[model samples]
Target chain A: MHRIRCPFCGARDETEFAYRGDATKRRPPDDADEDAFFDYVYRRANPKDWHVEWWHHTGGCRRLVKVVRHTVTHEVHWTGWPDQPPSLPDGAP
Target chain B: MAITVRNGVACCLVLARRGFAEVTAERLELSLEPGRATIGAERCCLPIAPGEWLVLEQWRADGGLRMQLEGDAAGLAYVSDQSHGRQVIRVAGPAARDLLGRGCRLDLHPRKCRPGFCAATSIAEYACALVQVDAVPSFDLVVAAGYAESFWLWLTDHAAMFGYRAAIETVDRP
Candidate 1:
């Protein structure tokens, strides 16, 4: 079973969290072109290695956290506040 | 060992304004640490989140802690009186940990979760805020009012194996 280390509630089972979509998706400016907005909302990269995603600690702190994980192995490398970027370690893939 | 469940206690959900958690904590003179509670003679302040605390106290005709919080820190926080919206149950016994472990995932080991520790999680499919009140291996579970009946039934049913007794008490004033 996968466990997530919640900054506020310590490590807990992943079942308590809700997997939000990709955290790497950035929203386009309101004045941006239609295509840009479309891609921002609908397009997402499904990477096999390190990928940033969002997870909501619904059952615990009720906060959104950004997590870097490997898609194939489901290994979570790190988790932090949604507004902050995950700091990758040296020589990390 | 005997397990006892006490139902109905006054509670309030206090949400601090952004960047004002410390201000609110100062006003209440309570610690705002996650997974812990600061107990006073008449009240218990539990920090359920970074900016949220669950204040539990016995009901009083003068409004008790809710009155004091509003009178002092209304500008820095939003206090929602949950006295009627939630039901508080205290479970204590030698088998308390075993019974709670059936639904709770938190490690209830005395060394890991000592007295005054609190957690917001699930129990018997219902959301609950749990607090370890003392070293007697006692715990207080706060569940939504709507689920009170079912949660109570679930608790009593499970507690039967360990031999349990329940008491419904009117709120006490200090």
Candidate 2:
């Protein structure tokens, strides 16, 4: 059972949060070329190691949070507000 | 020994804009801090977020706390009268924590979540703002109006084991 410690609502069951896909993906500037926009919208890397993802605390604070987790082990390193930077996990490259 | 549910307390939600905490504090006459509540003579203000607070006061016949706050701090904060939008239920008794623990994930232990601690969490599938009101383990649950009836039913059903009573009182603001 995974429990996420929400910055606003404290620790809650993982079911309380909805996964919102990759947080590392940045949208291209409006003035950028169509190719850039296409890649930004469609192309995304599925890394095996530590990756940042978006999780919405739908049941609790109803706010979006950025979660850094290890894809292979399903170990969450840190969870923080989307606008804030997530702390790096120990021993992470 | 008994569980009591008190319904219809007046509540107000205050959302302070960026860099407006000082103004809010001055206007509301309560120091604001996340996860902590400042109880005054008339009302209690619980800072649920960095810039958000839930002000709880006794109900009155005339437009209660909402009107009072809007009249005082409408320019400094966004004041919404949640008296009707949400139903305030006070659960007090020796088994209050045990009853709440059936659905809530929060640690209701006096040491960890004593008086003045408020949180937004789920209670029996309904989103609720749970506030510890006193050391008697009394809790005030602010639930959405739409789910209030059903939530009350669920609570009463569970509280039957502990001997519960429902009371609807029109309390005057002090």
Candidate 3:
């Protein structure tokens, strides 16, 4: 099983987790019109190299984390917090 | 000394907390390494995926742990120090197997839920964290803290004829 580190609860088994969705994507400014904000929140392009978010220990600590993964290969290069960008190692798939 | 062959230790001092009671117990002298927490307890050397644990300290009517939880709920993680929200119930002294067998689906035989191992099972119509306290098949059940009074009454009322003499215990107790 893949072990993912959470910003709040440290590393936990993936079984106690749920994939939240793309992490790096941000919504438009809060001042933006309501319709535009709704579109930004709902619409998303399934990109190949995307940042995925995951929640660990749902019943316990309830913290979310991001994983830099390939959509096609389902391979994750690295994981980090929402504010931090995932770092890719050299020649990583 | 009772010899146990298992993955974790049956700590003499079990801390059982229920709903919002703030269950936080500091492991004494546990060695924390870079990525893992190691304990040289009598039963197991705990070092695996996570450093966290479902500590099985007994729940007492005396309120030693309850006072601690109420005093410092902010310092400990909400998962552990939820004494106000959950109930810490003790199921030990021989008939524990029979008491638990009526509810949980897990096998309480020494070959399965042996000393040092903890299981998350359903009891009292809700999910609970159950731990093996001894090889003879005693268990400590960590239930939601809100149900503490009801659970305590259940064990005392139902577990009497089955050979359980309701008594308070600590994790340090052997």
- How far residue B46's Cα lies from its native spot in candidate 1, in Å, is 0.8
What are the lDDT scores of the predictions, listed in order? Answer: 0.82, 0.79, 0.49
Rank the candidate models, highest TM-score first.
Answer: 1, 2, 3
Residue-level error in angstroms, candidate 1, position A37: 2.0
The sequence of per-residue lDDT tens digits that candidate 3 reaches over residues B1-174 is 111111111222222233322233343322222212232333222211133444323333334443543354444433333434544555655667777766555456656556655544345555556656555655556666566566666656656567555554433332
lDDT of 2: 0.79
Let me know the TM-score candidate 2 reaches against the reference structure: 0.88
DockQ of candidate 1, scored on C-alphas against the true complex (2 decimals):
0.74
Cα lDDT for residue B15, candidate 3 = 26
Better of 2 and 3 by DockQ: 2
Q: DockQ: which is higher, 1 or 3?
A: 1
Candidate 2 local lDDT, B125-164, one digit each (tens): 7988888878887888888989988998888888888887
Clashing pairs in 1: none
| List of chain B TM-scores, one per candidate | 0.91, 0.86, 0.51
Model 3: how far residue A13 lies from native, Å = 5.2
Q: What is the interface RMSD of candidate 1, in Å?
A: 0.8
C-alpha RMSD between model 1 and the true structure:
2.3
